[model samples]
Target: MPEKTIPILPCRTLQPVLDFYTALGFEVTYQQRSPNPYAVVERGGIELQFFAMKQYEPAVSISTCYVLTDDVDGLYQAFRAGLKETYGRIPTRGLPRVGPLKDMTYGVRQFLVTDPGGNCVRVGQRTGGERHHGPAPQETFARALHFASLLADSKGDPAGAAKVVDRALALTDETPTRVQLLQLLVLRADAAARLGDEEAAVTGLARAAALHLTAAERDQGRDALTRLADLRGSLRP
Candidate 1:
């Protein structure tokens, strides 16, 4: 015996849904206008179906699907490329956006994608990690990143992530190293930018820039440094 499952989510309309999924390289497997408005899209083995509700609002829709895959990075890259090619830039920080890939404290590395219909697609791969119930009371750089990533990447709540990072920086007793500080500040800046808080973003990036690091430290934090640069580029007027 064999079985398969597909999510049928609600959308305000089907045209934008079709356009968005097609842009992400999902082929239109089926569509219908009779009986009711419906469409189906497929990418590899994954299939998603959408039903139209004329009065439905995608902004408030909480419909979602979980995609478990071994190649999280590859899928993210493909989606990112497709979105950028179609829109001339990848949309982030809002509906119809693809979030940056992140590894959470839990046993998963994932990316959050919000479709045009505001349905969420959480793509993740399992990794060895201690699954915890809630956020820890105490603050540390690592704990901060974990919590922030959970909000910003997993839940698409950059505002919450920004608050978490700010609280950690102001309250941490972990004595973070320069590289760690740089990483935290970069994330803070990113979250702020996503929230349309340009001043906070500038302040965070400037603070990160002011931190001194040895060559080895720079090498150790190349990823954060690169993101810092990208944030600067995005912040330009």
Candidate 2:
């Protein structure tokens, strides 16, 4: 027989916590509210237990667990689609979102998804003998945006995401194309809002809104605007 370990996490509310994981394809196996508040959820053989803590603050708490998967990419894609379908948009600035996959130096491909309670579920798979050829500058910037999305949306660390996007923007060429600039500004606005910096968020959004978009850039701009609106709406009042 094999031994299995399940993570016990704390959440401000048990029902919403259960709902979040359920939306991520987990099944609620057990739930109780009268006996000090507890619940259990399972998906693909992974089980997690959560307890309710009335004073738990997701922004300040540091709790995480790892879920090793045999198909990291597939699982990420499924979660991404599920999130988009449920939320109208993949929340990249306040709520849970699937992160970009990366081949870690530790010899595994991995990504992450944080529950609404700020419990990080690191999903990883062994990448035996696989080498990562560094990406080009544009590709690097794209990866940075993906990482920022994960930090802001999944980990509830918009401040951290802002730092990553800032470096990405700095490394960008001085005379970047309109599309490139638009993307960077949009991401900046998202991170700012998540960090509760309304002025910065407005400034970034204004800059992005003023950009002159080409026909192709118009399509991307529309999507970015929707994301920006969602991010702004989620900001603490």
Candidate 3:
């Protein structure tokens, strides 16, 4: 009367897959290399298994899974600390990277994590509040932020996300809110850095840092501020 499904993804090799999850505080439960290379990792209530495939390429991998966490922010911090300690930095691009937490237009607070095998583990926690039903934000920049976040973070297309943010900046006639401007600039910085445009990233981060915010705005944008700091850290040697 019950069902539990564990994803079995393909990896170019088992050690990398194991090491990546291990760095994220996952414990190795089962592993084998003699007959067929396979390994399983577990953290809290989540579990993932991997099998080796010699011809597999992580760049083109399309495998993914969804994981719901009750303590999304706390879990994120743990993963962040572990990854930084293990790899010396929290990777923001390419395979085996962790994404910043975001509140989506669809009423979810989530982040994307790609393992060494390119299997994206989308981890999220439903935010507090009653669901509000209404048409999407009509303003250009607000709309662009939604679309750009999906493209850049969810779909892993930094170049496309950068284009969306640029178009919004050029076309928006209405002035954006302080938080809106901050989010847009931070997202721009992320897209730029991932695309290997360090100058643009620096400019965006500086602009975001320069914006004035009241107590309310600062409290409201606490998460974005945290993400902004992460982006800035990424540029450091």
Candidate 4:
């Protein structure tokens, strides 16, 4: 199965969004012109698709999608400089509902800006050098499931990580994608072990190990399980 693409925002205008992303140094990885044109802009492991929507209003939506960048300041600076060089003003600030940059308490330096058509876009930089992007998902469920791992690792908050995994499990409960579901289970188990929740760790690891984790993923999970087992084992003898 091919990896799933994350939907960025439902867009009515393609040219402006395309131009905006292009100006931000994002390259188009995929583009289709028919039946509802769209484009996927990607950099590093980040992939986001802009879908053409006939409705131009900003509907209440959970995620227009998130962009994790290693160089938040540099990207912001670059965009600021590009705007100055092109239009003599920052294109971001002029947008409606946009605000000055603010440092988030979660250690993520980020800012929000509205697109030309009122879609909210967030650009975040994970603090403490933690990676926010992970392997691609084979489906939407898997993508969301994998996102839990990234969120946990990115924030360095074990509780937050566990919550994301639980959310993913709940969301994927009815029709779970094996790869992602198992991966998330393992991640949650790891988080549980980190928090010294022995019972939860054992249950999570047992469930994950029962699933046929991919060779590489299995190794990762096994390593994590081993560490947890060792920790628990030490207290026994």
Best TM-score among the predictions, by candidate number: 3
Please state the error at residue 31 of candidate 2 in Å: 1.3
Compare the candidates by lDDT and give the number of the best one: 3
lDDT digits (tens) for residues 1-237 of candidate 4:
887657566777677776666665678888888987888887666666788877665434333456678777666666555544554444422232222243443557665555554566678787755444334666655665445545544433567878867766776336665655565676676567657686887788678657765677655444344333433332232
Candidate 2 collision pairs: none
Please identify model 2 stretches exceeding 4 Å from their true place: 129-168, 171-193, 196-237
What root-mean-square deviation over C-alphas does model 1 reach? 3.3
Evaluated against the true structure, the overall lDDT of model 2 is: 0.72
**Candidate 1: residue 202 Cα off by (Å):** 4.7
Q: Which residue pairs does candidate 3 place in steric collision?
A: none
Q: 2 or 3, which is superior by lDDT?
A: 3
TM-score of 1: 0.81
Backbone clash pairs for candidate 1 read none
| TM-scores for all predictions | 0.81, 0.63, 0.91, 0.46
| Residue 145, model 2, lDDT | 62
Per-model clash counts, in order, read 0, 0, 0, 0
lDDT of 4 at 187: 65
State the RMSD for candidate 3.
2.3
C-alpha local distance difference test of each model: 0.81, 0.72, 0.86, 0.59
Q: List model 3 lDDT by residue over 15-82, tens digit each.
A: 98898898999999999997999888999889999999899999899999988888888888988888
Order of quality (lDDT): 3, 1, 2, 4
Model 2 vs. true fold: TM: 0.63
